[model samples]
Target chain A: MAIDPPYLLFLGDAADELAAKTARGVAHWRPDRCLGQVRLPGCKADLGLPDKTIDQGAAEGARSVVVGVANRGGVISEAWTDALERALDAGMDVAAGLHARLNDVPRLAEAAARNGRRLHDVRHPTRQFSVADGKTRPGKRLLTVGTDCSVGKMYTSLALDAELKRREVDADFRATGQTGILICGEGVSVDAVVADFISGAAEWLTPANEPDHWDVVEGQGSLFHVSFAGVSLGLLHGSQPDALVLCHEPTREHMRGLPTYGLPTLADTIARNEELARLTNPAVATVGVAVNTAAMDAGAARRYLRETEDALGLPAVDPVRDGVARLVDVLP
Target chain B: MAIDPPYLLFLGDAADELAAKTARGVAHWRPDRCLGQVRLPGCKADLGLPDKTIDQGAAEGARSVVVGVANRGGVISEAWTDALERALDAGMDVAAGLHARLNDVPRLAEAAARNGRRLHDVRHPTRQFSVADGKTRPGKRLLTVGTDCSVGKMYTSLALDAELKRREVDADFRATGQTGILICGEGVSVDAVVADFISGAAEWLTPANEPDHWDVVEGQGSLFHVSFAGVSLGLLHGSQPDALVLCHEPTREHMRGLPTYGLPTLADTIARNEELARLTNPAVATVGVAVNTAAMDAGAARRYLRETEDALGLPAVDPVRDGVARLVDVLP
Candidate 1:
């Protein structure tokens, strides 16, 4: 019998041996290619082959490829991104470790999208299909939200998680990058994969998953695409969240230089929230303000909020004080 | 004489020729070198220099520096920052046109500080400043506060000016950068330069020039040194103001990565305001929040305000609605 082609797995230096073997199993099934391992400098010990010559192995038509990476903490550097992009361009289906939170996935996806390549989720991989329900079913109440770069999204997510846990709510706050996989499955940092996993897990746990057993997945950035770009929307569409909370500040100067959606004043901000509510059709929820009190005095801030409330018909909460538990109550 | 060594004025394309010339005047005063005019690309303009030329310029002597960026929109570009850093390292004191907004200046300052250089303020040719007793002070009752960025500061300052004028108060806002020059005779950006010029003008316009007029000067940025590395305490020791209004966000998440001196909470934020009040010993004046309300409902926002007020002892005001008018009322 002709020798079966070996499977190849490409990863950062952090994958463990079992993960590599699991990847190898996926590779072993490929008919045309044999599993050939090419380990770079930083390949994780769990993934086996370390420092294998990648260039030489590729020249030999390694049928299957597996790339491994070590856990270096935080977001993958640009250098790693460039290397991964190069590997993808070379016709390798990249399986990245979902060790880092999903914060940088949108950026990576944007980069990949620019290159006309799609990143796939190695864990719970599935086909794309539209849901008949038209609304994402909320399985785990976990949610993550953040801004493009420095908009305090991670802090908000983490704080929400901490707050939820404090309230004795079985909330699982997973950062979409590093902290995500630990809470979910051993899925790579592929956003699609994560979303699929989330959706699948929600389906699997539904009815059985108590409302208190909420999975509060923290989003990486702002609502209007940017940080995780279309991921949040995609997640919302796929999962059909029960409620959406927006964290906002109410100042013209703060809103300045930002992409204007006709939301300049507190009144305008509320109007925009309504518009978002109408668009997403999710149970429109309360708005949360991460007020930087050090920046403003209490009385002045109260007056401003009062005026803003008078303008907008809904309620608002401070994420720091009221916490996520209160947010859950306020959310429809 | 040898044409006064051909004075050179470096500027971004957005600067008015008159302003450029005025900036060059400062350079002209330094007799040691031949001035070579170097024009930078404005935020909206294309970078005229080729990459090779920029590289060469960066490699050249530090004294052959360029000055004058009208806006920071393009300052973050590698080519611009690298070349500018190179020029500054080659021994040039960069005097650029900065916006009078608080948010604008700090970024510029941060960038410059990153390269171990400081942005200098160019005095406006026609502004004035003067001091008045408690009765004649512009912010006598309302403590006029200023922030650091180039754009936000200017907007706030101008808005305050408009508000005071609307209230028919004998109040005037002075740029502290300009006042610095008056006290010391030199600085960068319009505010400081204007402050300096006004200070000089105040002297020139004293009983000797116009002794009856009192001036309220506004400064840029916080007294604390905020940079990529971290926030430093006592960055604004000698440069402290009579009364200060600090801007901050109240979310713990927002404050997480930030270098703060106090606990990270709404209450902490409030306490910090009091701390600032105690530290500056300035009348714990009006507090402001540069809010963005696009994500929340107005009613909830109002409650948030009440909560914040209950937390902090001081009162808050919306800069857009009540800030300017209150400042006018507070003016002595």
Candidate 2:
């Protein structure tokens, strides 16, 4: 689902800055796509962008209004209805990554319909997909896999895409989750898709490209995650990545919500992921490792990266601290 | 998801006996659930049960009218609406596994609501599911892992459940697909579930039971099948099976729909499935092999079974030809 930009980022009455994480991500990664911020009167969050009302954003040529705030329950609150309707009336599409669909709201739906504007519920796929054919498609693809959920897969993927682009190599970051989707301006939330079509959805997201082009596909879940390994495996096969970047948050106690399962060792994670990935791409290689080192001191992070590189014989980097230049060097 | 039995089978204008495969499975496995078969004019399929109208079947204590025939495109035909309405009008619940949802049809919806009868779309899940907790629960589970889809995982599961029960062991067959749901009278079609909930749905299907009781789970897809490995992986983790019965169709040339891919070696299949299954059930073990020998002659079938057991050092049997007694004996 392509969400057109420049976007008017909605930070509707957020409780705090953290509630505007999604908006911040868009402003950080795709500033060119973001035009301005739209906040409710009592909103505590801010993206530090120019404040614009619906009419002002429309005048600025903003094509879409993104509900980028992460509300308490990922809902579209009643307080934001007026602004959303105004955006539609102003000839701007509305996109959201919320648990509640934008199109499901009666008032908003009627407004969008009246104005002939699209409502993109990015978390839910708006199109039907066939079961993955598993036929390898053309293009160089790199996928970010993790030892668990929320282990910097998206950040690593974005870094790779950015690094490859900086090197003047043709590349695209294929998002697979909500925040990633909002950041990329498009991508299917694979987890929301039917189980039968997980891989199929992945295949659709990173379709055939030039042989020299790199599709850095954002991964979802982890092969070791009990709650979501299925989504991970399907995405792995669907992406059919020629190169993989293993992502991990070293300080994580266990899989996010599954306390019973401990984090898998890096070696085990790589071996298992490569094994399953071989079903579609026999030449699939783990090019590098990206660690979330925010929990560790600078010295500790450096030592951990060095030890990881030495032990696994693969380049390791903190995507946030160190750029992904070293990681891209080993791309298959 | 349970559609209470005894069921009045509905075979509306079926093209052939093969169209009634689901009904035949139920009648063959659980004849006690079969009260009568209902046929529309021109229906070529027959379960050989006593023919009855919807009103007559309901009068005979049939609690549900199951649309047991597989129509073209798995659709709920307008031609069959009258019978379905009559079933609900007669105070019996209506159930079907079709691409078109039962409740989506206005006529059927009206009839069902007017009569206060439930409409069961077995292909779609009716209840919301939480993500798999990955915590260990009581009860032993034996899951059938296949080398490809439609290689008799359901049949193997059912056979194992039957064999276990015959030995006076407490056991239940947990279905993970549409036919399996109909066969068991209640089970989720895990493939139709949202990708995020595949494992969660599996956990719900085979929930905690007595420590000694067994839940024989019917698996879907193959770890080697690119099209469906995700579903298979999620089901494996969710099942948390103590024992696994590897099911294979020796005559298959490639991973189901994927022409370019070949099947993985049984040794690799066992190793990978066991490696992943251990995440949820650390003591998980692959106990035996179930071979579908329908494509081979009796002598060749025997030879193949013998070769499989000799190669893997696992007891191998043809579920339909021989029983799953040996497989059950090796259960942990």
Chain A TM-score per model, please list them.
Answer: 0.43, 0.99
Best by DockQ: 2
- TM-score (C-alpha) between model 1 and the true structure: 0.29
- DockQ, per-model, please? 0.01, 0.91
Residues forming the 10-long window of minimal summed lDDT in candidate 2 chain B? B255-264
lDDT of each: 0.37, 0.91
Off by over 4 Å in 1: A1-69, A72-90, A93-142, A145-217, A220-332, B1-9, B12-66, B71-332
Top-scoring candidate (lDDT):
2
Q: lDDT per residue, candidate 1, A1-332, as tens digits? A: 01123434554454565444434433322323434555556555432333344455555555323333334453455545665655445544444444352224566566556656445433323443221122334344534332222333444555665666676867654434322332232322224332212223222222235554665544432333211222333333333344444445544242223342222344433343343333223464444443322345667766765664566544444454444454555543
lDDT tens digits, residue span B166-209, model 1? 66655444433432232223332221221112122222211211
lDDT score of residue A291 within candidate 2: 96
TM-score of each: 0.29, 0.98
* Native contacts recovered by model 2: 0.92
